[model samples]
Target chain A: MATTLTREQQRQNTPDRPKPGGRPGAVGGHRNWLAGVAGWLWLVVVVVPIYWIVITSFKEQSSYYITNPFAPPAEPTLGNYGMVIEAGFIGYFVNSLIVTLGAVIPAVLVAFMASYAIVRSRTGWFLRSVNSLFLMGLAIPLQATIIPVYLIIIRLHLYDSLLGMILPSIAFAIPLSVLVLSNFIRDVPKELFESMRMDGATEWATLWRLAFPLTRPAVVTVAIYNALTIWNGFLLPLILTQSPEKRTLPLALWAFQGQYSVNVPAILASVVLTTLPILVLYAIGRRQLLSGLTAGFGK
Target chain B: MSPTATPTTARGSRNGGLAWLAVPALVFFVAFGVVPLVGVLALSFTTWDGIGDINVTGLTSWQAVLSDPGLPHALWVTFLVMALSWAVQTPASLLLGVFLANSQRYRAVLAVVYFVPLLLSSAAIAITYKALLDPNFGLGAGLGIDLLVQDWLGVPELAFGVVIFVVSWQFIPFHSLIYQAGVRQIPKSMYEAAELDGAGRVRQFFSITLPQLKYTVITSSTLMVVGSLTFFDLIFVLTEGGPGDTTRVLALDMYKRGFQANLMGPASVIAVILVLVGLVLALILRRLGGRDATHSQMEGA
Candidate 1:
């Protein structure tokens, strides 16, 4: 049955050519089975820690102590989740949402216009300078900038506020975001822009209506990437926000760590809480996730 | 100017004016990005601790960065960690990707499992792993893998291993997807032909699949090289450059000197070197990896 399908697939793949490899009947069945098992084994190893976290999230502290760590809980409970929630997980969750979405929206929008201008504008020198700056940004690690960023925040009186975090996040996000979006926009059909201009659309309208809509994949890709970057970010929020009221998820998680050393279940529980939204987002957009990453970053 | 020429020139100038609209981004970039980068660079020259005023002395920070006992060892350890992690992750991702591409039944499920690590903040992952790797109540003891359960974050070798594992685990699925994309682009007939040739799966993978995956390999490796160099958050959260700075990469060290020590100058120098490495890696990858390297310019959303 497999040999028959292989022959049929070959005929479709290369209609004119003969088979490239050797005989058809006796294949490497044993080796194929081994490879298949090897592949599954690889996946199992990769998935174990993640599975450990999820299962541990449900297990009670006593159960976590007595039972084998690898075993499922004897009886799982929402008690850990309750502890995490009561510890004000939702406030931090909201702070994260505010920071992530707040950064993403402007980052995407401003980057769209900037990318449109950078790609379409006729002037060469300005475009070159802008491009190079963004490119250089690919290397500008946040650790290097944390002090100066801290200074700027206090100087501007934006310190410890969402705006302080949001603004810089947008700034840092631009180089990569503009790079991706502009490349994508550059792929947009020239005729589309010409037609829109002929219809008397303003430059802004042409960008928003014709170019931006077409670049949805790239835009959504940028949004998701920025959201994750902002959400998962530690140092910026750590340095910038001192007030517990304003702290993001990462900061809050750190607070949880210092406060809850022995509460293993609650810590894992918070990890579950903090990690869930993005994981769900990943699940919904997993297909696009890889493409976005490889398309933007991979050679 | 002719009327049409004048209007066109006027529009061009306006576009030029609008181009500076990137200034909001530029201002922040210069302030948050460029200013600090330059500030760090300038700071690296001085002998100042991170606190008070920087005492500007040329090459002092550079001298410290180069001659400091920890600095060179840190660099070596970094390269070792990155190399070993790449060794582990690149092949792992490629094989997993190939398997997922072939099987459809649990692809999404498996992908979610793999990608969950990417979602958590590095601090959170560090925290969770700390709990798991705990010497006492931690699962490491409970599982009887006592040998595997050293003070993973405190000892130099074990700390290095833990850091590498954490970083690699988070990004491996990402690398896998890159491989999967490359695999999908390969025409189906190649696999069938190899099968017909009595090529076993392992043989076929080498002869067919691996060769075709050159672009993905180059891209992912380049990313890994640059990424591992500046990796800070995990190291920062997990070890805080501790068990006596055993896990300090360039970025982590830079953070320690510049921010923690308030020796802005030395930190800046470290930052410059780190950025320089990033640029050099990017340029090298661009040259060696073909036109696809330019595709990264398109990466932002």
Candidate 2:
């Protein structure tokens, strides 16, 4: 093909045209073939741990102990999942769901208003101070606050309750949510706000009718980020909740390991069960995540 | 509705305007965020066993910590873990990001693999690793790598290394994603020009790619430092500052002194220090990143 193309090119007057194909093409083709294999190899590395957990969840106790740890179970069992659910995973899941929603809803609402006021209210000491105070949160690691947080929870008698878990989660989540939302709100068209104002809408009404709707993507992104953070949270739940009934999924999974120490199958089973809600949430919100990443980082 | 307002009326509205919107958040934050923080700061100056009554014991915990044999080593370990993780992960993710960015076919797959760890709960991952690293029945034996597997939670030096590795593992994906996003933004024209000049892949990366990714490098490094310094959950679950307090970080130390040992004052001191560290790091990052206004604008989240 290259020889034929060279002869054809020799006969032609086109200067930029070159020989079409040869051994060099095969080398490039081989590189692509190698790249394809390498790509699949990378995917396998990513998928393996997840696959391991899922498969382990289905294995029996005997399979976990004395068999090839890397091999698939010859006979998968539902017993581990059965035990996890029977152990009241449903209660923990419900506790996590309610608390996360309870905290995130109000937190997002408050942040939405606060961000609006800061962005819309022209420059002022009060707004500056509020923004600074919130930004200070970026400095205050939750680790530093853990001891004090524990004390406060204990004093409020929130130690073993879901409310204890919900409040601080909201507080910690608020600053970043406010940061992201405010930046997004600042980017909203000034024309819309002016139009709303001309139509006799109050500041409150304009905020709701215009800013809220315009900032939906940012709002959704913040919500999903907070959801994952709250759902996967272990420290708050671990420190605050003593009873199994009030525990979140991570805490419950932790507790499962504590009680069933060597029961590898049960432990893996619980891990699978525990990660399900987060996985479901992530899968559903995967589109939002991509948009959020692109919007936040793509400039 | 009017944009025009007299100064007096605007001031009046401003005074009342913030009232309705600000009160709830003010109350919430004051009660939950501010009070606890201040209370803990105050606690740091006092001696309280967390029970009957509060008493200001004035720097006794601080003195105890300063004089204690364990404090320096713990701090050292914490510092080591944070530094080592940043050192190891930054390059690894950068290389991984470069590879993923250059190879279109493997981009999606490698990215998912790198990021899969981020999706798992740290506690779950820590526990799984704990089991996997177990000396006797775990994969440590089968792989003939048992000696390499420390009783991660039980050993001193290894405990810190294990925690750092675990935390870094979780973050590499996140950092890679950031790098990938930045790398993808480089206009094809630049690469094409470099190729026209007969620049090799390595040269193009060094001359064009790295320079273009300055903002990403800064952002990711700052995030890594801030994250590593504040890290708690994985360390807490995995090591619990075990094997004679060798793995205790500032955060873990604070927790133990304030909550476990009932020395609220010292714990608060540690908390205050942690806050200062965060503030200092953020300040440094802002200064470093400040020169590039476009950088922060690009890093919207």
Candidate 3:
């Protein structure tokens, strides 16, 4: 499958002009072959582990041990997935869903409003300071602040609850969200905003009716970006929550390791089930996720 | 509507009204980010368990962190990972980026293939690799390769190397994506002109691509440094800094002190040092990048 794709790509990649036969031409040809080989090598290195996980997820415990690990399962079964689901995988999934949505929605919405204000209120020292504040937040690693965060959560009586995770996650996410959203908002034409003002629209009205719609791409970008981060978060849940029931997917996966030790197939089956939602999300929003991640660095 | 009745008034009122719109975000940032950060810094100077009354002991925790026996080893391991990641991941990604950029067809599919590991959770990647590298029934033994079967995670010498390889695998795609974006920004005319001048692929890459990617390389390097220093979840899950603490990094050290040992003060000290290292590295890289940009600009002139 991969070879056919590469062959078609090579056909399309043929240059318009014929090459001059010389030392440089020979070297160029050698480099192209090297590139092709490296490309295929990288494809294999990436695909094999993912392929292993999916295939292993389908094998029963006995077959997983008996069959060739690299081969397709001879007795493919849904038993591993059923065991995972029976072990409360759905509960963890719902917990992850609630926390992710609870955090990302408020973070993005607040960031959009804040970003709009930052870009539009050009002359205010307060807004300028706020922008700088967010930039400074980029340097503060969350690991460094976990100690105080735990204490604060305990003080607020929110420790061991999803709200504890959601609040701090939202807080940490705001800085980057505002940074990206503000950059996107600044690209909107000044005339569009001015015209909206000329039509006697209040600033709030213009924000919803004009700026919101125009910056939809940035909104989606920040939304998916934060959702991915919060969804896969481990440290927050590990530190903040203790109950077996409150465990998010990543923490649940960790817990499963100890409980099902030596049960490789069942453990891997849980791993596959836990990651399926995020993989689906990535497939849907990959372009935005990629562009958003690299967007800040590009500047 | 009148033809813009005093544009300044409209602008002034709008600005004033909207300036307050940032208040909610500001509150969150200050309460969660700013306060906690400041709290951690202050707490580093004191001895306080989560339950006990705080006692300020000036410079004690700092002194302990500086002299702690385990810290130096953890720092060494972290530095090893950082150096290895830069040595291995960066150039590989750059080459992959160059190849992908030149490949016209199947670009989207190929990129998605490369990015799959990155999209999955760190815990998931760690578990997947753990199973794949399992000494008994893993892919190694299953494939019947004699040399492939080994206790990868159990051996102290090999455990750190395995962790580094996994970390590199997960992040290489990200660096490649960045380089791909950088490669796309290079104007095609330059490459075409080089080809016209009989410059081979190697020379063109050295003269055109490398020079154009200087800023990107620096930015990515800084990110790699900071990321390696603070990386926790994957390493924690994979080894828990196990097999005689061979793979322990600074973050894990902090986790142990704060949570397991209940040494909050010392943990705070490690946290402070980690943040300082990140900030100093970022500033240095920025300064270096700034100088290079100006130098190149002068040469261009």
Candidate 4:
């Protein structure tokens, strides 16, 4: 199918004959220049706010209001960071870390196993239905399920706890994780599985020794992707947890917004702190993150 | 070869055993995903406060939701946001994606720069924008832009616009990334052929790039629409649907109905509507995009 599309593209893009004096260089130069200008403009649009957040985080409250917002702080201070840390930022950070780890690890593990089953057992009615069920989940927005989730969490007596957030997050992460992982798993050759089986390896051993190692890159991708989502999740924490001490970083940022009121520097300092961990993660695994996210679309 | 034949038969029997590997994930999905979804649908028909005994009030909440003045206004706001996102974000991202895909230098660095907003949490983005859009002490004011000196989040007329702009700003990078991937797939020979045919860049874009991106555009549009429908966190932090509910969306209304108003029935109704709208829109987009894209591939798989 893809080959046909590419062929069609080639045919349509090519004219019946070449034109004289095409001036290809002139056109190419103009387009490249245009691209460069747009790229730089976009860089400014994206970078300035991040820059503003970082610089503003360091400025003293009085200095923030007195100086130009874009200018570097003449008198930088860690006072805002100090204030954020004192306001239980460390607790929020821990809560976020706990939730992300708790949710992402189990979600990816279960998803990997399930995807392996789905890919290998493609002919079973039960497995086909299961695959459809997971795909259907892609359409089930969390907004639609929050009310019932709230009730379920309450019934389980897990409300106002990190587990409340962790459980639903795992469920929500499963569909995409399964989709991406199964796509990766299917690309593995059938010969490997058959050979492993012929060697008297049980399915359990095959999964561990064969599929698991083969799909490690995909495992990492799903892990990082799900971790990013769970780490940044706000709605689950907001609706599920009530205690300030249980707040995650996103919720903590919201709390800071209100508590600081007009203390913009303090609020932004929390923003910078809240975003820093994820930024570092992104910097490290950006290629994997991008590939994992766009993997579903590309296929 | 003889050993392989015997084990192949053994593997057939072990298939059911291996199916048990999916049990843990299925249990989680059934507990948190399937149960709540079914419960929400059932709860939508009943008039029950969170703690009280359940009483079935058939269509009462749905009627209330349909008749509520606030509901229509909220839907309107959500639709406006969706339209703005489609109109502004889609084209901008496509252009940027095309530019980035074509560039040979600084491609990786530029792509990362554009993706910064997406990597950050929505709450952080909202807070950053909230401070940045402050009329007096913001970057706009700092840059001496008199027009941006107004209270962006406070003015009723401009609040939703600012919310949409910020939302688009955060998401454009995401859509652009998708477009960039799509653009990268088109063979370079196609572009070279176009250039050989005396087709200029603009002509090549219209003829080759746009046509090839049809599926991607549909995919991104569907995502943007569904996302805009349920959007809450950023708007919640930035404006709280305020300056008089100008930015209020259905998700926020649903949140308020359940949490603040203690009207679980109406909230469930709204929740059902949001899901239905999302599903219907996704289906429609799939149909419109020619059904040959990822959806079919997923099903075929």
Off by over 4 Å in 1: A1-35, A139-142, A283-285, A288-295, B1-21, B47-51, B189-204, B290-292, B296-301
lDDT at position A266, candidate 2: 85
lDDT (tens digit, per residue) of candidate 4 on B1-301: 1212235565555557657778888889888899999999999999988877778999999999999899889888888888987898987888787776543435666787788887788888888888888887776777788987889999987898888888888888878877766676665667778878988767887888888777778778877887787788988888998998898888888988888888999999999988888888777777887783336334212
Per-residue alpha-carbon lDDT of candidate 3 for residues A61-146, written as tens digits (9 for 90 to 100): 88787788878889788898999899898999999999999999999988988999999888878889998888788766767899
Colliding pairs, model 4? none
Q: Which one wins on DockQ?
A: 3
Give the per-prediction TM-score of chain B.
0.85, 0.85, 0.89, 0.90
Q: Candidate 4 has what TM-score? A: 0.91
lDDT of 2 by residue, A90-188 (tens): 998899899889888988899888888788876566776777777666556765777777788888888899999898888888777777788889999
Scoring model 4 with DockQ, what do you get? 0.34
Per-candidate Cα lDDT values, in order, are 0.73, 0.71, 0.80, 0.80
Candidate 3 overall lDDT versus native: 0.80
lDDT of 2 by residue, B234-277 (tens): 77777687767777887788777766787777777777777777
Q: Would you estimate the TM-scores of all the predictions?
A: 0.87, 0.87, 0.91, 0.91
Off by over 4 Å in 3: A1-31, A292-299, B1-14, B291-301
In candidate 4, what are the lDDT values of residues A205-292, reduced to their tens digit? 7777899999898888778878887888889999998889999999988888887868888988898888888778777878787755
Off by over 4 Å in 4: A1-34, A293-296, B1-12, B140-145, B292-301
Given candidate 3, what's the lDDT at residue B58? 91
Candidate number with the higher TM-score (2 or 3)? 3
Q: RMSD in angstroms, candidate 3?
A: 5.6
Q: List the residue pairs that clash in candidate 2.
A: A46-B113, B44-B265
Model 3 CAPRI quality: acceptable
State which candidate, 1 or 2, has the greater lDDT: 1
Best by lDDT: 4
Summarize candidate 3's per-residue lDDT along B153-243 as a digit string, tens digits. Answer: 9998789788888998988888787776566556666766887898876788888888888877876777787788867999998999887
